[model samples]
Target: MSFHYETPLVDQSELAQARAVMGAGMARILGYFREDGARSIRAIEEAFTQGNAAAMVIPAHTLKGESLQFGARRLGGIAESIEQTARRCVEQRLAPSEVGGEVAMLRGCFNETLALLESAAPPSGTPRPPMPGLAGTRPVTFGTAPRTFGRRTG
Candidate 1:
């Protein structure tokens, strides 16, 4: 049997809600990145690099939730690993060596996921669909930036 991957994030209805929310914040979304998404990723990487597990966990959790909401399954999966590892380290006080291994794993996962997301193409021969209810609204594009819409607490 061929196996298929399923995303753990939003369903179609939830996605619609997420899109509506994101549309409302379209003007401020890019600015949220500060450095066009690079800064946020760097901050997350540095937190992991420094062994600040709590910080790493928080950022990863936030990124994962947002990514899932926006249909970014691969990125969300990578972030989920980071979050899980960080949580293990922080909550269970895992050994430094274990945490180091976890960090390395997360880095690899993130890189691979990023590569896949970057290479993904829009469905061939299909025109891009218009955003629901966004007619006449200024179109906002993130270009190559990875983004998602979802709730984040804290």
Candidate 2:
């Protein structure tokens, strides 16, 4: 069965609201995201490689919170899914193998989110370009291939 991923690249209203509170600090926040986001992604992969399903929760949760803070709702949602799946794997006594599908889904979402952010590059030193209404929507295409840990298979 196919799953329809409907979350957008970012939520403009949420970003605008955050911008109001953060003011000029928004630039630094985006910069932190740019640096730490990739690190968190890599951390998730590393956790998978170690066959530690529980370890996935930390990075995924961290990414989820950070993504939400930066108004990247879709990315945050995907991260949240990863976190929940990891917890479920533990709670239901499922093997790490059982998490393969969710991991693949997260990878696809992460890749999509990264591509959108990269393409929307603002001028150097400028904060991330706030994606407006319906501006970041792209056709969702979930991959079926099973991605193995320790390798960038998606």
- TM-score of every prediction relative to native: 0.47, 0.64
Q: Which candidate gets the maximum lDDT versus the true structure?
A: 2
83 Cα displacement, candidate 2 (Å): 0.4
Q: What is the C-alpha lDDT of each candidate?
A: 0.53, 0.70
- Give me the displacement of residue 47 in model 2, in angstroms: 1.7
What residue runs in model 1 are displaced by over 4 Å at the alpha carbon?
1-37, 95-154
Q: Indicate the TM-score of model 1.
A: 0.47
Question: Cα RMSD to native, each candidate?
Answer: 11.4, 17.3
lDDT of 2 by residue, 8-127 (tens): 777777766766555556665666776777787787877777777788888889889988875778788878877888888778766566556656666666666655544443434555
Instruction: Find the 10 residues in a row with the least total lDDT in model 2.
Output: 120-129
Structure candidate 1, residue pairs in collision: 70-149
Model 2 earns a TM-score of 0.64
lDDT of 1 by residue, 58-95 (tens): 77777677556545565566667667877887887663
Whole-model lDDT, model 2: 0.70
